[model samples]
Target: MDPFADTLQRLREAFDSGCTRPAEFRAAQLKGLSRFLQENKQLLQEALAQDLHKATQLDSAFIRKEPFGLVLVIAPWNYPLNLSLEPLVGALAAGNCVVLKPSEVSKSTEKVLAKVLPRYLDQSCFAVVLGGPQETGQLLEHKFDYIFFTGSPRVGKIVMAAAAKHLTPVTLELGGKNPCYVDDNCDPQTVANRVAFFRYFNSGQTCVAPDYILCSPEMQARLLPALQSAITRFYGEDPQSSPDLGRIISEKNFQRLRGLLSCGHVAIGGQTDESDRYIAPTVLVGVQETEPVMQEEIFGPILPIMNVRSLDEAIEFIRRREKPLALYAFSNSSQVVKRVLAQTSSGGFCGNDGFMHMTVASLPFGGVGASGMGSYHGKFSFDTFSHHRACLLRRPGLEKVYALRYPPHTPRNLRVLLAAMETRSCSCALL
Candidate 1:
């Protein structure tokens, strides 16, 4: 079967059926998605490793109590399972039917998704479509009410441009060169501890992870040692052999990092064993502002630390670029935190923390400008998928009061109309 056509057809049928209107049906689908994930835990882990060398612990379920309407999900390979299943859980709870396009780079993961979703979901309602750019292009030719796309900004642009033909609203989860600032007031030890985790986790594949650290020359001198120590503590003396850390996603990603490191100075952990596709949790210091590593989104285990004169310099540096999916600031001072939050716009921000904002469903997650657009999580996700059909029902038999509004209006009629406008008031008082 043509996966895109068949899948879209089924979702259209389910949406038109009116089953999606019932809150009960939505809740049931949410349960099914979560149960399917739990039952097939091992399968998800295996497929992820084959696709990206990511650990199973990095994958987990998100909110499930809300429901949406009919949605098409385009997931990426970075965090394959969570990116695919988390939003699906929210969609079902919001009463949505779905057509999902799992990333073709991870062939095994796609098969696992196909195996599990049909088992737990209403088979006639939810469908998995598998293919690459051509299949995606074919699918986009059709009209969908909403699209939830997770990928790079370059492709996100094409998705959004195509969506415009149908006026289809979209949520684009895209990436950017995120900047992490270290203020003069920041504790060196605390800054090092937080930045190390944010820059290296998932082998630095996260969109919101700190792409590079902006610190003063004096601060970097103190911070460099602590960051190196933190990385060693988390991944052991040899990060290459540690099970806690994962490898870069693919060779293309590896070469990208290799080029960046070639252009910068290494302050700490500049080690790599390409034979096993392993790159150390290395930190690069003294990187030039014009360098390619600073110019692009560094999605790898490599961390490039650049020196800045002041917080103003850091803010100015970040301002010149596209709005990032996230802006991470580490400062105990209220003034610095307020200045960054108020002045800059990002999909989200974290104070004295990194990448933890995504876990909370209360805050709607998304990007702005070049970073991409729209947000969804938990109830927000449900709302994102379902369109609200507003109704303003009126009661009958209030003719006398409204009759005063008729033409040939006079003092008496005006008085009556004014009186009628007040549903509750002092009746006898000239009103």
Candidate 2:
């Protein structure tokens, strides 16, 4: 079925009708969205918990921020509402019509977003569509002014290629195997705690979450016990039963994570429960660079540790791969942290922390190279959905003044014009 055709046509008609052109209308839509969140807080949370096995609160600014006509947002399942609504909010606030395609992998939350969300907003300005891969392929066949996609790099390529056909501008917020380097000079417990909290949060499904660690073999040995202590303290001996802990989002993901457990020596928690889709807060040591775990982005609660002799090697290793969405380094030494910061390239970087850079609204969030391109959050989001149109209004009465260089090939006129330009330049330089 061409499920998107009718809805897209309707939205195009609405945009052409100029109903979404007013600042007042845009504000009303944003206000309606705020009301929707306030009223359906519990429902949204429940849906998130049901779909991703966890719930987290999301915690936006203005520019000339003109909208890009109709925008398509393709969100991932891990943070369904967050990924979907973050872009949607920007598109609407910038005065653009939006079509949200919530991930069908998180069917529960997708239903909530598709069904209940529209009630609070003007239907003509916004719509939510539901689909998996095939339907998404069909949806991409139509043209949109802007497309914001968040998913794996493999699929990000597909989205970019599809958008290329229509020459549609796009923002790809794709995932990569984010790297976290632990310096030998740091506190093991602190590093372990920070790494564990982020790696295991929402079962480690975050796109920006640290995927693996690189440290000296001695540091790796030191980190193991500290990480064990941290995990035990955070989730207890039985992490599976902890209320704060989360389960894998699907059986397929659980199986894939289970397969990765075999790649390295399991230094901490390797238990899995098929019934609940639970994988313990795990840390693997003696992991090779070529292993399956190292080859892909582990979007689960599994952290693999690869040994490196020194910081130089670590930076070189990181630089060799596709630049990740997020990068982290833990060091009490300011010089050491600064060295890594200056030497590496990533969408975002954090020192002595794990992906906390993303929490700050002032810094833009995105990736470089294969990780992805473009950024959003705060002013970046508003700008992402807007086209920076150049506007210059000159006085029409300057025809005589502008005619000096217009036609006559005279040396006198050329010299005079050059002198005038040089005089203006010198005057500005003095100021």
Candidate 3:
């Protein structure tokens, strides 16, 4: 009587029948996905407009990237299309049957994905589930081979707990309070421009966005004006009307962000309108470490600057908190940047800029400690979705050669076997 039972059973059967196991099959699925994007470009654009957002291998002694069957991809509402499809591509390319659960909060994009996406893929190997928490809870009750989730840490725990009952492997792409340190040696304008762009990108819903600033009070003084200039240049004086700036995703989110506006002195912009879910590209000064803005992941268009007397103080501040998803340090001195890098830990790090490290496909992206776990991107994506089953292929005629490893062993046999197995000879002066 479970609503998802039939679809789950069908995908399981499709995976078990070995229909998704071939490289040809996986390649075709990827091609189909590409086609879906290309053919329906306008449709996707319109859907996003409504929502207001959006390989390698080795020889016989190597790891095989084989799929984990029946993967569940739980994507968040922010940047819905990209987050949803990126994981989908990885799972499909790895030859797994996937069940994608797009966030219901992004109703417009979710509708398009649910109604249109299935037409592009093999129906037997893929499905799109639509619902809020209640239905998602029901769906997670059933088992899956792997789970990939992107969202807040609060809900990440729920996902992890559910995954545990089924003994499922997971990639929890959770968010944290990322920190950006600005050394006194840096150009205030250059640092300000980079930080503003990333902090307010996607209305600041980004998980890897620089959450707050740590700088000397002297640097904070100079940077405040520069940050204001950057905000003005980017979003204009009337930021609420700027087409480039995005609104908070929901009333709840807007209210949450509006509440944070009170945590620190409003230095640049602290405007809000519930009618449009608009929260202006804001900057806060005089923020304390104990404020809600400093304590939580500020997933909105607000930046708080906290004063640190020295580089050591800033590093100490960062170390005390839970490891962040991403960390940024801006300094004219390479040694200063290196010092920060060596002294701290984060899921990812970028020197002199925002979350640019994540833009490259070559780097693996995931969190450590409380931030999250597991990494995925480019070839890492293919690998993350795969189970590396160690395999060795030998000819039956080699049984005589392998007999040295068999039972009824002796010291002579052991010596011969050891000598034959060694890739290099051991040198002993005593010998």
lDDT of each: 0.81, 0.87, 0.89
Task: Using lDDT, give the best candidate's number.
Answer: 3
Task: Output the better candidate (1/3) by TM-score.
Answer: 3
Q: In model 1, what are the clashing residue pairs, if there are any?
A: 66-93, 66-94, 67-93, 67-94, 67-95, 68-94, 68-95, 69-96
Candidate 1 lDDT, 77-112, residue by residue in tens: 888888998778767766778899999876778889
Q: Tell me the TM-score of model 3.
A: 0.83
Model 2 TM:
0.83
Candidate that would win on TM-score:
3
Task: Pick out the ten consecutive residues of candidate 3 with the lowest summed lDDT.
Answer: 53-62
Q: CA lDDT of 150 in candidate 2?
A: 94
Runs off by more than 4 Å, candidate 1: 1-69, 404-431
Candidate 2 residues lying further than 4 Å off, grouped into runs, are 1-65, 419-431
What TM-score does prediction 1 earn?
0.78
